[model samples]
Target: MEQEKMNLKLDMDVQKLETKKLRKGKHKAEEDLKSLKTDYKKLRLSMRTVGLGKTLEQWCQEIQEEKIKVGRWERKFQAAQMQNRSLENSLSESQNERDELKARVAELEKTVHQYRNRNSVVELKASFGRIEQMKRTVEELEMALQNCEAKIEYLEANDDHQSEQLHYFQDQVTKRDHIMGEAVV
Candidate 1:
C-alpha cells in the first residue's frame, strides 16, 4: 500500500515536469517567432532596394516555417495538458478505491477474528459439558456394579445356610434307625 502511494506521487511529479517543459518550449517558440518577423522585414527592405536574392532571404523563409511548426507544437502541448489533468483525476479516484478496499479488508479480518474467538468459546463450553456428563455416567455405572456385587454376596451366604440344614436332618434319621434296630433285638 505504501509503495502504491509512492508510485502515484512519482507519477504526478513526472507529469508536472513534462507540463512545465512543454510550457517553456512554447514560450521560447513565441519569442523566436517575434525575432524572426523583425529580421524578415529588415531583410525584405534591403533585398528590394539592392535587387538580389541574399542568404538572409533563405534564412527568413526557414524562420517562417519554424514559426508555423511552433504553432502546431503549442496546440499539441495544450492537448497533452488536458490529458495530464484527466490522468490526475483518474489517479485520485484510484487512490480512493484503494483506501476503501483496505478498510474493507481490515473489517473482514476483524470479523473473522471475532468468529474464531466465539467458535473456540463454544467448543470449550461443549467439551466441558461432555466431560461433566461422562463423569456422572461413570459414577452411576460404578454404583450399579456395587449393588450387583452385594446381591451376589447375599445369594452365596443363603446357599451355604441351606446346605448345613440338610446335613443336620440326615444325621438325625441315621441315629433313629440304629436305636429302632437295638430295641427289636
Candidate 2:
C-alpha cells in the first residue's frame, strides 16, 4: 500500500512538469505570432511609403505613359537639331557671301588706284564715275553684310535657347528613367 502511494505521487509530479512545459510552449508560440503580426504591418506600411504596393497593371500603365512622353521629347529634340543644322548652314553661306563681297571690293579699289595714275582727263573723269558707282556698290554690300551678321547673331541666340531646351528635356528623361527603375525594383 505504501509503494502504491509513492508511485501515484511520482505520476502526479510528471504530469505537472508536462503541463508546465506545454504552457511555456504555448506562451512562446503566442509571442512569436505577435512579433510576426507587427513585422507584417511594418512591411506593408513601408511598401506603401516606397510606392512598391502598386498593382502590376498600374505599373505597366505608368510605364507606357512615360514612354509616350519620352517619344514626344525625342521628336522635339530631333526637330530642334535639324533646325540648328539649318541655321549653321545659313550662317556658313552668309559668311561665304560676305567674303566674296570683300574680295570684290578689294579688286575694285585696286582698279581705281590704277586708274588714278593714268594721265588722260577723260579717262580720269570716267574712272571717277565708275569709282563712285563702285563705292555705292560697296556700301550696299556692307549693309548686306551687316544684315547677315545680325541674322547670324540671332540664329546663334536661338541655337543657344534650343540647346537649353534640349538639356531640360534630357533631364526630364533621366528623371523618368530613375522613377521607372525604382518602380521596377
Q: 34-122, model 2: which lDDT tens digit per residue?
A: 99999999998788767676799988997898779677767766776676677667667766776776677677667767777776678
Q: Once superposed on the true structure, which residue ranges of model 1 sit more than 4 Å away at CA? A: 1-119
Q: Considering only N, C-alpha and C atoms within 3 Å, which residue pairs clash in candidate 2? A: none
RMSD of each candidate relative to the true structure: 57.0, 9.7
lDDT score, residue 83, model 2? 65
Whole-model lDDT values for every prediction: 0.63, 0.76
TM-scores, all candidates, are 0.33, 0.50
- After TM-score superposition, the amount by which residue 102's alpha carbon in candidate 1 deviates from its true location, in angstroms, is 53
Q: Write the per-residue lDDT of candidate 1 for residues 1-185, one digit (tens) a residue.
A: 99999999999999999999999999999999999999999988776554344377765875687567556655655555555555555555555655565565556556556656778777556555655565555455555545545554554455455445545644664576456445533
Best by TM-score: 2
TM-score of 1: 0.33
